[model samples]
Target chain A: MSQYIPRKLTRLPADYCFPAEGDVAAYLFSEEAVIAVEVALVTQRPLLVAGPPGCGKSRLAETVAAVLQWNFLHQTITSRSRVEQLTVDVDHLRRLNDAQRAARPEARTKARALERDEEYYNPGIFWWAFNPTSASRRGLPANVGRPRVAARCGGVVRRPDNQPQHTVLLIDEIDKAEPDLPNDLLEPLDRRSFGLPDGRTLTADPAQELLTIITTNRERELPQAFLRRCVSLLLREPERDGLIAIARVHEPKVAPELIERIADRMVELRQQRVDSGQRSPGTSEFLDAVRTCHDLAISVDSEKWQQVERATLLKPMVAQDEPSRRP
Target chain B: MSPAGGRRGEIHLGELISALAGLDCDDAAQAATIAACLGFGLRAPDLAATGAATPAIYDHNRALPPPAARRSAIPHPPGLALPASSPAVEALPAQIVPSQLASVGVLPSTDSSAAPAWLVAGYQRLASERSSPPRQTLFPERAARGVLTAALARWRPGDAGADLDLDALVRCIVRRRLPQCLPRLPSMTLDNGCQLLLDYSESMVPWWEDLRELARQVSGVLGAERTSIFDFAASPAGARRWRADREAIETWQPEPGRPILVATDFGIRGEPPCDLRGSGWPAFVDRCAARDCPLLILIPWSRFFWPKNLGLHPQLVHWHPATSAALLRRQRGLGHRTAR
Candidate 1:
């Protein structure tokens, strides 16, 4: 039997700003990238994206999640993350106890034993999504009882409620996580089902059609094994038009002239710094300058120009002195 | 050299100029007086009494005194007049402050057969093999970005020249030194340790499934387990999780013979804490551990940390196929622009 997932659910909260259609394909490699991702989704391949810092690597995942209306799961990596930390094990015993108390008060003793077993072998978030029972069909047979209820960090998923047929997993900054951690996902990610502890396998049969999107800042060399599994797409520093669109999104009140000035300056600064000594300002720095100028009501006069220029240029130059001097 | 040494040299030239210009007075007298004061090199030549003068003549008929032929503290004896027609050296630019010319000095000429003394000393260092690179002239934006990125790109092994923060470090390293030519690959390995864990499997599904039930159980268990267990979940769970991850707290070691971590490198200790140590562990360890196999899960924990600590991300250490191509394209464009 097929599971029912709520289709075309509105993802963005009411107050959130949706990306304007005109600017949708403006970012570098954005149009082709979206096409690449769409193809990956159709073919069921995890999308791997690589780029420099100012390049919008993370946004691809966010955009895919936004466009597809899939529930987005974002996990940022750190030096401290472990396996269980990323995909948590569920607390099955407590779930059974609560289920027992609410429904079958007469079978309290038997329910208690089940509760202990559940506690002993609780599944994590990975197990819940990987398990078939978690995504049980809409109409269950009478003997099965109400479908299993799984707990999660975001919210609980009632097995009886519509199972999320499509999920967009965004692994932002995958380069930061432990080198070995990425390879672990190969088997379960490929098989679309993971085995749980109680000899009960969690299978998303027909399966959880996951659109996995992994982003890396290209800070280090990724293992070849991980790179081979996914369709890799790269995001570069946006071109003039793309940058203008990005600036518009962030600073709605920004004047066209100011946006162009900032974009031009940013591109020039990045290019020169890289040429001078590999020292380019990031998008954040440019925006911060724009906001600062906006806040203080300052214009780029010769003196005040130094203020913005110093923030963007001189300081980074001084900081990067030795490197620039190198052969 | 003594600070007063230049004054000594100046006094001799001052007297000579005064004598040749025929403006003999206190300035000229003072040179003699100072010579007297310093003792030696003070005797005046008898030719001064006859007032014989010649306009900077260079032929053998009136050859000038070789500045090096005599070293009587000053280049010439105090009373002798220099040739009247000697060319006056125009005063150096006032803009060149003394401090700015701190390296000013004289060098002995190797080709003394033809070269002048001043030229020998002035051009020595400038012509030396080891002068610093010329200052770059870049547009402001280019200076800000390209120069900065290029500065970051220069980092080599053992150059710990910074105490930069995360943002500064990434701006310095990743953005600056990024290879201009990214490789053209059918596929490219991400050249970095910065990773992301996109858990697409719906975090909310587990949340909706069990939060109420878990909360109810916790509420009930509070009486039996006491508040301490729940407190454990609250207080140090994050920290404990971090520590446990490092300590391999969850690894199930059934017996003594099983190797937990394989490769051992004590030398890797001083590097960033995240640097992987036991890379070649047995596969049995993977089976035994409750955690996912370390190979498959990619998390971007190293983002700012690598740039801050190591200056460059580990992934970009080698050239991946596509990155090499991208870098090549960038470099080619740069080369063309430069050629023009």
Candidate 2:
């Protein structure tokens, strides 16, 4: 039997905004990246995305979560980040304070009774993704009364009368982490279950597999073993049409012609930088330049437009050896 | 004792007895004693006897300090002394007051050109500065990114667009270009000790300062204690250990078991470097091998200025415009290998 389950293509809600940035809406994904995401979903493996900086690698997870209506958990990987931080961390200081309060003679009787409770234990994203009620029961400040409930059916999270919510774990900048970190994720990625430092095992429901997306800028080489467990895709700089589409998503109010011109100029500038052995500008820079032009009402041929281009598109102090001669 | 006082004392005595009994785990007896302490008509024989035995509980009321004595014992905060008299205020002249401020220059004059010429000139200068855009100095990491992305085209293996490991290429570009954009060196610590030898000869005059800065950055990243610096001319005879604020040339000697980094433009004035030709190159390589020290040649020249014979040396590593100390520290092993 084929492992892939049929999932209806759900159009994003018109008013849907990414959880991280409430003002920005999800951008249209390229056909190739969409297929790669689908393959990752069907296989129930982490999607490892390799790309240049600001190429929408991190935003891919947020877009996916928004479209699927799944809870998004983002963690930016740094060199000092430890594996335990991804699971859970006990608030020892708070617990110690409680202990001290309990020993006080004038302490309230009720307050002393609650000192031994689990309120002092801080739950990480994995804890919430696996057992949503654990957060509600612990009376975590983040989740006070109402608990998040959604059903995970065939790797997609759907709203149900009463069911567990699925989560999308975004491991961003995985290359910045220690070499062993990718390998260390083997057990968690394979079993979809990890034991907390507190000795409690958090296992995902077999029916609803947790979706994970990892992004890398190719700063460091990830171990082969870890790569084997993931479905990887390289997100190259999109083609001209794709770049225009992205720009439109960022500034839909701008004229399409103007956006196209900006995108084309950005592409040319990137090519020039490439030829000169310099790094090329990414989609974010293109979006910024377009937005600045639109806000300032600066025409492409105007003198002030050159200032905007310099401020956003080109690196400073590097002489534009050749003037933009394009009419 | 008065009847009311006697009754109140008896109740207190009974309550204390009940607490003691409760501590002893006599639940039934404790409850009965509590009921008797409530002054109910029921007078249990055991309650009366317990109350009598616990006369010390009634002693609490007797031991209380008299109200007058307690009030006198209560400590009071020290009183703050107020100033004896307020100083007389010196009033400003009536003409200087806001109501009579016609002489004061609080408001703009009717004549717009009343301002001093220098003040007007300064305002004009400020306005001109504000109108003009500031010079752009690209962020080091951003510039590094630009170089890496551009270099990607060259590193791309085929049209399939499969994810390629560009870690080495990225290190090369970042190690070369970062020094130009970064004002200061990045601090890092390396496990293995190394020495940095810079080419300070005449031919490298153009890139001398930049190469020296790169060396200092590399030293900081690799750790200063473990990393040493030296200067070399065209020949081994011109090699000398680097001393701060000094140009004295001494006999060159290699530290055993430590890696050596030679930053140069690979150009020798008048004649080619002695080590690049004849048995001198082989002999130098043998000496480095004998001491178990890896020799890394860093050519601090941009890709545009790359010479045709750059790749001839087995230990030579060409520096690009995007080089950074972090990348150097990361690619130390590759630096030890032959430059391709």
Candidate 3:
């Protein structure tokens, strides 16, 4: 009577993110992007998204989670971020603090609670994504009841009416961390399971297939072994019509003529940037231009348009033809 | 050699074949148009009757450089944009037979006509893969894990601080002694980014792509800003790198304590390459050693095939696929911390 597969994206939705807390961004997926995402899901491998900054590589993960009605969690990688921090981190400082206080005779109950390693174990993004129910209990045995809702951690997720079945874990700008971090991460990723400081190995639920999306700014080359495990995808810059559609979606009230003019100007500015071998203005800048035009009433032919262009599109450097000092 | 085993087509025919089922054979013009954009030379006996010219591969992604900018002598890369409009705009009614059309992974019709008409972009050019050269080094990804980075990141010993020293914190907590400043308990950092000297001389024509890949690998482990990439003509004594702030090629002055990585052939290229005897490479090595800068020269030759005259001061690594992080660590004497 019915032929439908659950949690499969057939077409790009008009607005990928929905009516949730701070989920208002629009995402228009290209066919190639859809294929890459599908391949990753099918292969059970993490999707390594590579693209210029502001190309919505990060947004794609959030959108995918929303479309599938899956719980979404993300971790931002930085220079200081380590492999241990991604899966699970033992709060040594908190443990020490508690230890100092619990050493006193007055805090006998607190000292007993501190004895359990589960109290100090903080679940990382992977842990939360793999099994939120388990992570909520802080690596305690299944006999332990689910912790209070207050124990539920931070991350943007649109609550589904039904019980959540899957999670989309996004590790953003993976290349930002030291080269060792990624290689160290491969084991946990491949196993779909990780170890806790309390001598516990928590594996992903067999029924729930966790989708991990890893986005890199491509600041450096990720190692071969690490990359080999990933289903790769590259997001290209939006074309002329795509930009106009994106502008209309971002700023619906703006005049169509104004949106067209802003889009064209953005294209020209991007062309100039490409010619100079610099990063071109992306969709975010285009949206900013559209919003600025609507708010300031700056027409393309008007003198104020150049100022808007300089402020939103061209970035720091002035175009060579603009002035003498630029030379 | 037989055609099936030795030769490969410009476009994989199997991909085109599977695409025929989705097409409307009645609209022969549309099918032919698709075929043309796909770089297919459909010389059907019936198609030729329509006087339609065969479409060559339209590489509008600008894969080649401009004729005037071409530097044939130095083997300069011809930039990534595909070259010239080779796709025939004329459609063929005769070649529209479904029997003729058979290829796999055809271009999805969702692509606007305005997009590059090729089957796929260079990043996804698995359909038209170029035969690799004799010596192919990893480009997109280098090393297994962070071997290369581990070897080079060592000598450039980073600042006095790293991430929070968990061991120190645990010790302090057990000893019941707290430091004045919490942040002072950071660990000793590994990684002092290196200066990369890339040789773009005519002698390095064969390994130009490898050199580019080398830069990407080094920059990957060490942040691009930390890995100062400079273009060297031959010797690193007076190399030049484009300063983004200045928008000009400025002399590369190596910083002290920062490890130096030179991807050069010691200015000698032959069947059995001559050693770095008379070249200024010896002087360059000596100069780097004096600056307390650990030097690693990545030669695109086989192991033990480089000049032995320069002494053991500069760590020489064969820039080949066989080279791994473990090998790099052993070569650089960073084996003490090697996970292998």
Candidate 4:
């Protein structure tokens, strides 16, 4: 009997929202990361993230969406980021649906439109996550009822509960945004609803909390009021073990001996400080070394290490250092 | 050629000559056809504005990379549970110990006005309140950060004696200023508006520094603090001395209560497009708007005098010869030249 009931074999074509579950926690470096995700989910608050660049801050939002299987909304901030241009105009989608619904001939089919409401108007990533219709896991019915049956049954089956259970909102590299931008999230972060001047209140669906996350490279400092809302987690340069783990994730076929050998040397060099103590290498620097070694097909031992160092690490740094050496 | 004469020496036929010159003059009878074409066609209004002398270009200063995380000698001691909203930055006392404050020559009774001001008064006002230093310094590492920020902001193109006029014109369009002083096109018409494209790029490096210093001074005057001059006389390994205004770079966090002055440039050429839909400028604008940042993007310059992408975003303001001249004039200490 259970088998007789039609079941969805495939996920309806919804937006892919999160990154894989294991990756987010690893990248984010906090338990509160998920809880903050939950808070963003429940309260519909915009997530604010801060950290140095190359820390995988932007990737966390995508991981959340992939884990949850919801729509992923992404916006990357830059020095030129401005107000009134943040969200994509989802109004066009609403208008398209409206026109489609309007063209229906039957009064009862038209009545279905009135019943569902304009939850579709929410646009952008926020709209995808917060709009109830967007969050509805159920796809549109496969077959339309006959006109006589539609008249009797009112053309559409209206679900009493249409709220989304999950949504991921990703604001990437928020620090790159103009200075005023990060603090501006206070209201949206707190209320989970932004009031459109058009007299309509757009809200994240209550059942599915709006999971918002922001990332920054610390190019500029964000306002404290904006920073205080979330649990602050710093993603330091990954240690030797972490770099090994990252290399394994990217190149599973690479031998463990090779991975361990590469990680050990990279870690040792990174730990070395100049007399002034300023020669620290970042996770990015380490990763570049790994890629360089792989491209050169160099073995893990010291003989080929110089080639990796020359190609990936030393040249760029020396080139950068050359001009500043001027008297 | 007369500096002020219309094209071909027929001042009255300026529009006709401009029309013939501009490739985008679609309509033969349109009044602004020549102007629009010349505006888009002339590569560097600033360079054109300057008759001969070019300003030097300098490489923009790079910010120091983020420091690695380490265990603090004294961790953020567990007892301090910060409230949802901390006290206003000014109302909050310096968390530094009394000895440290004394060592720094800060008196416990220092007035609120004792805080240092920005390099520019307008910039000071535009800086979010959080960026303003409190009477007491809370973070010990702030001094280094302050110096780092100032140095980074001071980075500009090299002073290669490139003509500032073209650079200035390019910078103007890249900055995207409009309504105040619109961009000019070189139409044949007597009023083609190309004359307004005076070159000032040669003076840009000094102009930029003067402006930054002026801003620092203006903010300093209001706060009763004297601006300290930083010197660059050190040898490669010699001890470099930096004078940081604890009030400026250290305290300047972007705040809602204050306007943000975001400096952006189109570069000598535009940056690589971010996404498929020409996300370069539009993406930047949208993201800032979405995050609620009151962004003021400053297109400091363009590699070419004229760029095809100049008119895309409306909020942009291109730095005009008049504007650069005005800014230079205001900073007279730099001995900036006036428009002839």
Candidate 5:
């Protein structure tokens, strides 16, 4: 029988309405960012996003997952994060305890092999994503799905049912890990499969390609080999229109005139900082200022608004001091 | 298995056993027993005796006997089970530690903040010697060598000198004989051992390749073997070695005697100015002072906007393209005199 697959993937509308909950839903994607995401989906390649901190690099994956109704899994990369943590983590200690119990004649009742078998292996997100039946049976409260096992071996082993669903894995701040980490991911990423301790190869179904989104702050340069495999986009600081869209998404109730005024001021401030060789404020700061204005009920043209701007926008040291008085 | 075999081998075997145990190996108990029998030359009966003995025996035989006593017969081999106490195992020497081996540059001294009293005194002396106003001398080459030695020597501990505007003297001499100073570039020759560290941070991206080429050229001019090259970033821990080549540079700790040349844009973005109080500047300054190593900074930027007070050390030298050729010649002249 021929399997049914959707011909065309859903494209997000220019003014798509996001859900009331979650930061990612409220994110506004620029045209370039949208193109990058679309290219990644078509090619079944990971999207490598390079940008400054707080520039929506991490949220892009969440936004994609939400819009496409795919299972979303996120892992923050740290200096101590091991590659194995991303795939499957077997609890050797529990297995050892079970083994010790099995050796005792008096503990036979508690020494069942089932206690130490698959239960000892806490499946990582990739494991659940690859085996949809396992994911459905596990009954992730957040995900929308029902268990319909296609194949089963004993109570512990199962494969996905006929329904095809995708998974979006967000590897955030990948540059935080060791220098060789990106290179280490080459094999798993290229083949879309990784080896398990139990000799099973967890392969992503080719028909339902797993979507990977990698975000980096450029703290360290990623290996050229790894970068070549993924579609990349650099998210630059937004202009006035982009800023207004971002602010509006986060603060929907904000007056249009106030949003415009705040965006213009932010752009001017950023440009001023850059011209003076100072570190400019980013989108995060802009959002903070907008939120402050909204909560305090300050008008853009009011004297009280200037105080709020100084308190929120200017750094503590700068805010405390007055401009040099004439001699 | 003989107890008289290499102590190192036995220690490594013990470590392997402990590692396997930590991984909760299913056969860890059996592996540990076998390791004791073969590596420590303990018979099954001796293990039985130890297992039967009270906990007091474990405490009494805690420390492993010295390596020299490998040939001596002992009642127990102290390898019955992997020692739970960490101190019982011999600590690996710094030279052989895996982490130490992986790192390419000098591990900063533990006491980074406290510069030795002698080092401070030595710097004062060298600073004083070079502080003398450059007298109009007939022998500019001799004066240049004297300045170079003073600068290099002050980098070592137990030295003292006053501040001297040595840059002014170099400029004065170079400007006086402009035509004569413009000599053809010197051929490649071995220098007094020096390491060239380049800045390869994000801000340096545009100039990274060019700087690396310059470093390669500098390496060729100085004997390749004598000149070690490294790249560093303005990470939290001052600068760390950046590896670009397959062959790792030999691990070396900067010492008082060695000359360390750094080529950087000095435009470290995302970092406060080096002169700012409570910034990372003190940590950097202390690191250099702790080693008492001479530094020659090569900056590509214009002098009009250069950062000031890089460090208070007398041995520190800043050079730009406009003045580096003259400085290089002066350095080479010092080398020639030392050789003669």
Candidate 6:
């Protein structure tokens, strides 16, 4: 209630573990990231995150959600993603089916049920995100029989308690979406509300708390107008020491020397990738290399280590095409 | 998406300034400080403002410029069920047509050695999310983009001047060196970045809108971060842009290896001082040449109105509206005789 007790944090703690979410590894929010989150909360704007893939952009949202212990909802935007799908969609097919079925005499009792609009309503992420209680029941007020919660896709993160309220939302990989998608999000984000199909507006509760985190991989350029409205964050990939620290968190049992060596190797690979105009190795690749070496007992100096590096770090298109250089 | 949900289209930043003065900083420290200041001043507004002040919340249904219902296009062919995910791109072949496969000469292939060109191009179109639009510029848009990217006709690389050096690859193998990893072979890129200089002086009044549009188009081509913009009146030596890339009103100078695009008419309207022959204009071209920055001057006035006796220098193109690609090609020395 009332923006859910504004969480004004000075520094974002490193190596933060999510209680409700599973095995997210680490989210090392820098000082700027900390301020960005705070600014989003204060300004009531979406945090637009641009970064290399696997740079922990989504995790920032999840971590913030877990910290706030608010209801977490996420949508991974793809080429197929639509601005409408985030807010609400009517189950027209089901409604049509119900309409067809109402013609039968045996189904007379259920025929009148068609009059109930809730039967054909399906809430999108924004609905469940802003106010779950009404979204779960298709905008019907409470105390109506048990609310028919639509089966959620993978978007739902940690569920809230007996009282589920709106909070943090993660709109991941927005760049994968068409340019218009960001432009379309201007109002829903700005107003903290969107329009419903039934002509009713779904405004955030005066008490509702919401934090929107939108990530982009620079796959497509976002419109200038869209970028102007957001609290933008550019998350650069971590440095060598940062990578080593991340590796330790993801795989602690791996020997420090092995981690250091793999981290060093990843750094070298990244430089080559950048120079070659290829996608550079990210934290995810570094952790995978460290894990592979630790699991297989492949020493960095061992000839087999080259195979490991090729598999994890140097595995983009050009390198992938090369006949295995394994001796 | 609600069809009649809320007001739509672009919302200017000035109107939302109090809401959008967020950090545009690349430096983390600077961003943090900016955010802290915003947070501190967060409560200052409510405490200082009166009840007569307009509320920040943009209520859709009520007044405060009653949010106009956004007009949505009706899915046509009446009963045809189109997928909601249909992106805002042009009509394209949803599946690979065999007819497209044999058009070898028309459709050139990708530079990737891994696969055939047509297959890669088809696969890429199917995979990538995109939208489109372009304006008549000094450069030409391709039947498929990538055919003509350089702004000039006879182009020279300003920053990026490399192609895949197979020799470097061969040297690594010939030397029997399997050192850490494979040697890098950078693909050719046209430029390091694009820096645009605008003429905001009185002479440019008629073309002020054109100047702004040019900046947007260039930013649309090279990313906003890679594109820097400065506005000047009499000369570019004092042209100024926000210095966030490396702080405020920074002076214009040649960014080594970065191409410079200046949209100006030399303030030639009723003026002798602003002519291209003498004003700091020729000196500016020298600076760009010295820094290896290919300078392209886009003069709104056609070639006839262009000042006479101007010494030879940076390429100047007539920035005429609706200047066809064919004409631009001929001017750029890519005429029919040189075809192939």
Among the numbered candidates, top DockQ falls to 3
Question: What lDDT score goes with residue A147 in model 6?
Answer: 38
lDDT by residue (B123-224, candidate 6, tens digit) is 634435555455544333221112122353223333121222346546754696533433333222323446778888887888876776666555544434
TM-score on alpha carbons, each prediction? 0.40, 0.46, 0.66, 0.40, 0.46, 0.51
Q: In candidate 1, how many Å is residue B78 off?
A: 30
Candidate 2 residues lying further than 4 Å off, grouped into runs, are A1-24, A108-118, A138-161, A317-327, B1-340
Candidate 3 predicts chain B with a TM-score of: 0.50
lDDT per residue (tens digit) for residues A85-149 in model 1: 44334343344346546466675665543433333333343444443344332122345454344
Off by over 4 Å in 5: A1-11, A14-24, A100-105, A114-118, A134-162, A300-327, B1-340
lDDT by residue for model 5 (B1-340), tens? 2111112211334443443343233453443332332223342212101101010110112343343535546565566676575566687777853464454688667884597878766663335445756443211322332232232221212211112233543564467532322212222212244666667767777666556554444432332333455556663224433222211222324554556666665664535434434555445555656775556666555554455665555233443323433455464444332211
Give candidate 1's total backbone clashes: 138
Candidate 5: clashing residue pairs, number: 17
Candidate 2 TM-score, true structure as reference: 0.46
Alpha carbon lDDT at B97, candidate 2: 38
lDDT of each: 0.40, 0.53, 0.64, 0.39, 0.53, 0.61
- What would the per-residue lDDT of candidate 2 be over residues A136-248, giving only the tens digit for each residue? 34333343533222212122234462765767888888766543466666666666667654566666555444678998876444555566556566677877887887777
Q: What is the DockQ (computed on Cα atoms) for candidate 6?
A: 0.02
Fnat per predicted structure, each in turn:
0.00, 0.00, 0.10, 0.00, 0.00, 0.04
Lowest summed lDDT window (length 10), candidate 4 chain A: A1-10
Lowest lDDT sum, 10 consecutive residues, model 4 chain B, at B188-197
Best by TM-score: 3
**Residue B80 of model 5: what lDDT?**
65
Write model 3 residue lDDT over B211-246, tens digit each, in one string: 776766666566554566777676678876644432
For model 1, residues B36-88, the per-residue Cα lDDT tens digits are 32122434211101111111111123333344554467566588796777788
Docking verdict class for candidate 4 = incorrect
Candidates 1 onward: DockQ, in order = 0.01, 0.01, 0.19, 0.01, 0.01, 0.02
Listed per model in order, the count of residue pairs whose N, CA or C atoms clash below 3 Å is: 138, 17, 20, 92, 17, 3
Model 1: residues with Cα > 4 Å off, grouped in runs: A1-29, A88-117, A120-150, A155-164, A308-327, B1-340
Model 1, native contacts kept: 0.00
Please name the candidate that would achieve the greatest lDDT relative to the true structure.
3
